[model samples]
Target chain A: MLEALRKISDVVWELPVTHKAGMRVPARIYGTEKLLQEMDEAVFDQISNVATLPGLVKHAICMPDGHFGYGFPIGGVAAMDTEEGVISPGGIGFDINCGMRLLTTNLTAGEVEPYLKSLVDLLFGRVPAGVGSRGSLSLSRTEFRRVLEEGAHWCIENELGRPEDLARTEEHGRIAGADPSLVSEKAIDRGIHQVGTLGSGNHYLEIQAARPADVYDPELARAFGITLPNQVVIMFHCGSRGFGYQVASDYLKVFLKVMEASYGIKILDRELASAPFRSPEGQDYFAAMKCAMNMSFANRQVILHRIREVFADVLGRSAEDLEMHMVYDVAHNTAKLERHLVDGTPRELLVHRKGATRAFGPGAEDLPAAYRETGQPVIIGGSMETGSYLLAGVSSGDQAFFSTAHGSGRTMSRTKARRTWRGRELWREMEERGIYVRTASWAGLAEEAGAAYKDIDEVVEATEMAGISKRVVRFTPLGNIKG
Target chain B: MPYEFLEDVATADIAFEAWGSDLEEAFSAASEATLNVMVEEPGAVRPLETREIHLEAEAVDVLLLDLLQELVYYKDAEQLMLRVDDLEVTGGPPFRLDALARGEHLDPERHRPRVDVKAVTLHRFRVEKTDRGWRASVILDI
Candidate 1:
């Protein structure tokens, strides 16, 4: 598979259309030589399969963190002409709008270190987590529908979020065109109480410190709100939880029935099931997807509220006095309509980014005023045992339609990781390294060992060399609460 | 043991293969495998409740998928750690599965939690008959 790729650059490779049949475009992959070599071969199969989808422009893309996934390989990205292409649930993923949110606090690592354990424990107890855990808020069907329509705004109206936080969120935390009627009763029933939950399986909230030495770009770091050395910031990774999962599952069954029968679209993989964008099935899924998107925003906003309260309580200060302001929120699993220059012509393309971040460059429209000159912040969370990064999209990012890697991609499977690292030992090791940890399950803790994932620094470096997103600051873990 | 997790099939998720002499046994094996993915100790979930599942799919392979998905749905919607007590699979134009699943509401302390199984994926999903028995392969998104 590696030999079949054309070396386009030091950090880029292309799988030509001739590599496989039914491909409308070639496949563009971003990775360092080592990263490409380490990539699982299934990514080649999946990305090529993605290239075959109708109306795909430029090329199907695999980010540096690419790995084997069901339909579209995780870290896959593709831009399709809305009028001519198709919409796929696989491309957006089961966890609709699974995203990352970062917040800056006036407190420094030194100030928080002594109380890190209490903070993580309090958060672990407060935030719902693990298998089948419900949320902090209970809502009737009617109020949940409002959450679907209003998104984070509902949280703001309910006094869970600050008005200023909305602008910093992607799409202002509410995707337009959401029709609650398009959502199913099953999806609502599954996730109605999950609006504020941090679901298990790679979901977590962490306290980290952005040290002065790790600030790759001083100006960019300052602009993104990392003003103090060893600035203690909070970051969380989650999505719409079970509601989003059910939404994707429900639509997959619907698309499997109607994709070829109604729209005559035949996909190579059953997981690649899709429908024409204008078709009734496609329009309805898109509408419902937005609702899940809103549900996710509401979910994260509520979690953010909990984090603020916990920090304030542990620190004996009001959240406002601590200046726990949001830096940015970015969704990795999603499809958004954006105008991008294709072959020198501006066209609205529905860009599907699965496990890939939208790294729109500076001057990109819709960016908050503060970040307009700096570009949108991209939060790539590493494993709990490793440090994470803050990155800014660069102008050169448009080459891949402004998409970048999401995290340190998994290298070892869960069973293998569990076999190699004991959960109790891993926890002790992290403790020795000055990282406070709280988890719902020790078995899950073993599966997330740092060695189970590729090096985050290398992944971020590959994206930087590829000119998609640039490094701003690196934050080492001080505390972690894993689901 | 009727089922065993496949270590390398899924990197970010979990995959398993279950086997039995017939469709009913195979469905039960797959059900237990899916249950094991959610809880480290399946024996901890007492038979405090039961739910009846009826599903019809285009083929036997999809019926297996649907059965596995039903377990995940119960976990999410009802917080039930249901495992297959018994099931019957019927062959037809639309394959059918009828099962009685039994388990109790999740007790975090009693049932050691693992990752949540989001959905059953179509990637490499299959059901086949071998020389010895029926075999089903599933990859669960976590």
Candidate 2:
């Protein structure tokens, strides 16, 4: 597989269409030569498989953080013809709309450091975590349906967040065309008590600070509502919990039967089962997927509310005094319709981004008024021990269809990490480094050891050097709540 | 032996192979292995209650996937970390699975949890009747 790749540039490699038979388009991978050499052979196989899917436009692209996932590479971005393309659930992943949200606080790390342990404790107690963890809110069948249809608006209407927050969120915190009737009863039951909860394995709520040394572009940082050194912030990473999982599970079966058995479309991997975008099965999954997308938006919104309450309780300060405002929220795993110039012609394409973030450049019509000049905020989270990053979209990103790497992709497997490190020891080590940590299961924490992932700094650098994204600021972890 | 975990399969997920004298036992062992991934002790889960499951699929492999997915649904929705107390399978053009699951809600004090098994993946999923017995291999998205 490595021998088959042709070097296009310092940070790009091409797998020609002739590399594999039946490939509709070529596969292009973005990464440093060192990164490419270390990549698993399975990534080549997976990306090649994705290129074979019908109606793919231009090329099948993998971001710098790419890794071998079930059907598609984790950081893969593929655009298909809206009128004749296919929609595969595997292309979107099991955790629908799994993404990140950043909240900027007026308080400094010095002010919060005194109460960091207490704040983390309060957050851990307030926000449920781990498998089968239940939240404070319980919805009936009817109310749950509303949550599916309305998304974050339901949370705002219930007074969980301010109306202004909608402006800072991707898709205005709600994805329309969510058909609640299409969601399975089992999915509803799983989602009823899981909202506002953070599930295990990589989901986290971390408190961080930005020092002047970490700021790459001061003007852009200030424009993003990030101020001087020591400014504190909170980041929440989660998704639609069990609701989205069941939705994907249910639809995958339907697609397998319909696309394969009925439509007679053969796929190399069963996990890549899909239906045409205009087909009944595809449209139904799209509508149902919107419900999961909205559900995730609402889930993160509720967690934000809980964080605010904890800050107030721990600091004995009013919400107004704290001035904790949402910076931005972005979804990584989703398929959305967007217009991009394809060969100098504006065409509507269905873009599927799995384990990748939308990094639309400045002046993109979808951006908020404040960000119209600077571009969208791209949040890239790192390990608990390592640092995170804040970036902005660059016009050059349009070349890759306006998508970028999601995070410090894992280098080691969960099993290997668990075998190499003890979670209890890792927790103690973090505390010794002045980084507070709280978790439900120690083994779960072991699976996310910092050593398990590539250096976030390097991954972010590769993306910037590749002209896919630009660095705005860096965040050093102060404390965290791991699920 | 009914089942044994296969450790060196995939980096992001877990996989196990199960065997039985016939199809029913292999499916039952597969359920046990799935439960063992979540809890420290599979037998520690007392069969305090039982919930019945009835499913129909076109093939045996899809039937196994459906049965395992049903267990995951019950775990997340009802908080029941179930073990297959009884299972019956009838293979035909329309394969069928009727299962009786038994367990209690997950209690942090009693049950030591591991990685949460999100869903069963079709990524290298298989089921076959060997010369000696029926065998199945499945990979789970955790």
For residues B1-142, what per-residue lDDT tens digits would candidate 2 score against the true structure? 3887664566666778998999999999999988877766677788887899899988999899999988888878888889885788886869888989999888766777766778899988999989988999988887
RMSD of each: 0.9, 1.5
What does TM-score give for chain A of every model? Answer: 0.99, 0.99
Model 2, A1-483: lDDT tens per residue?
667899888888899999888788999998987777656677788888899998899999998888767789888899999887899898898999999999998999899999999999999999898877889997888998998999999999999998988999999999878999888888898888998998887889999999889999999999998996889999978988999999999999899889977676778898888999989899999999999999999999999999999999999997668989898999999999999999889999999999899999999999999899998999998888898999999998988899999888777777678788998999999999989999887878888899888788888888999899999999999998988
Instruction: Indicate the DockQ of the complex predicted as candidate 2.
Output: 0.60
Looking at model 1, give its docking quality level.
high
Docking class of 2: medium
> Whose TM-score is greatest here?
1
Candidate 2 regions off by >4 Å?
Answer: none
Per-residue CA lDDT of candidate 1, range B36-115, in tens?
98998898889989899999988999888888888888898899998896688777868878889999998888889888
User: Each predicted complex: what DockQ?
Assistant: 0.83, 0.60
TM-score (0 to 1) for chain B of model 1:
0.96
Report residue A277 deviation for candidate 2 (angstroms): 0.2
- Model 1 misplaced stretches (Cα beyond 4 Å): none
Give the per-residue lDDT digits (tens) of candidate 1, residues A1-483: 788999999899999999998988999999998988888899999999999999898999999999988789999999999989999999999999999999999988999988898899999988988898898798999999999999999999999989999999999999999999998898998888788899998999999999889999999999999999899999999999989998999999899999888888888999999988878999999999999999999999999999999998998999999999999999999998999998788999999999999999999998999999999899999999889999999999999999999999998899888889888889998999999888888989999999999889999999999999999999999998888
